[model samples]
Target: MEAKDDPAIIGDSEFTALLNAARQQDPEAMLQLIELFKADILRLSKVIYMPEEDVVSEIVLEFLEFVQQGKE
Candidate 1:
């Protein structure tokens, strides 16, 4: 699908703002970022054969770690 046609696709500025807020540990912005990846995460969950909730948790944990690493 075209990027513009994808609801998960945010404009560059909005994404940067969101990422910044998320990195600062803003729960609302973090949730928004999670929502953006929900579809892809769910799809990954199907192939991984784990509980859906666990899959989501694992990915979110990894994403948060990556974001935290950027602060260093």
Candidate 2:
């Protein structure tokens, strides 16, 4: 799939905004980020033959933790 046509491919500005919000510990923004990239994450997990639930959850958790760490 073309990157431009991919819903998982967010614009740079949107990504920056999401990163800022995540660093601020905004739950809604964090959820939005997860929802926005969920399809791509799941697809990747499947392509790698990983369990979707476990992989996705770990990814989300790690992402949140990483963002939170930026505040420290």
Candidate 3:
């Protein structure tokens, strides 16, 4: 079967496995993951913290640092 048809294709890709683990450890995963989740996170933050829009960038930067620290 082709990779597209193979259920195990993702498990065999180094990057995919790395990302899956990273996502579990870090809610934001990496940069692209941040982009993917940014909308949801921003909406949640608005509800809980009422943070300014500009604060989204700052919060994401801080979260990335925190996640990286835990990995090391």
Candidate 1 at residue 66, lDDT?
Answer: 84
What is the RMSD of candidate 2?
2.9
For all predicted structures, in order, the TM-scores are: 0.82, 0.66, 0.43
Ranking by lDDT: 1, 2, 3
Residue pairs clashing in model 3 are none
Quantify all predictions' global Cα lDDT against the true fold: 0.85, 0.79, 0.59
lDDT of 2 by residue, 1-72 (tens): 556676667888988888898888788889988888777677777765667788888888987888778752
Q: Which has the greatest lDDT? A: 1
Best by TM-score: 1
- After superposing candidate 2, which stretches have Cα over 4 Å from the reference? 3-9, 47-50, 70-72
Residue 17, candidate 1: C-alpha displacement in angstroms:
0.6
Candidates ranked by TM-score: 1, 2, 3
Off by over 4 Å in 1: 2-4
lDDT of 3 by residue, 1-72 (tens): 244674334333654555665656644347655664566668766765545665787777776666556542
The TM-score of candidate 1 is: 0.82
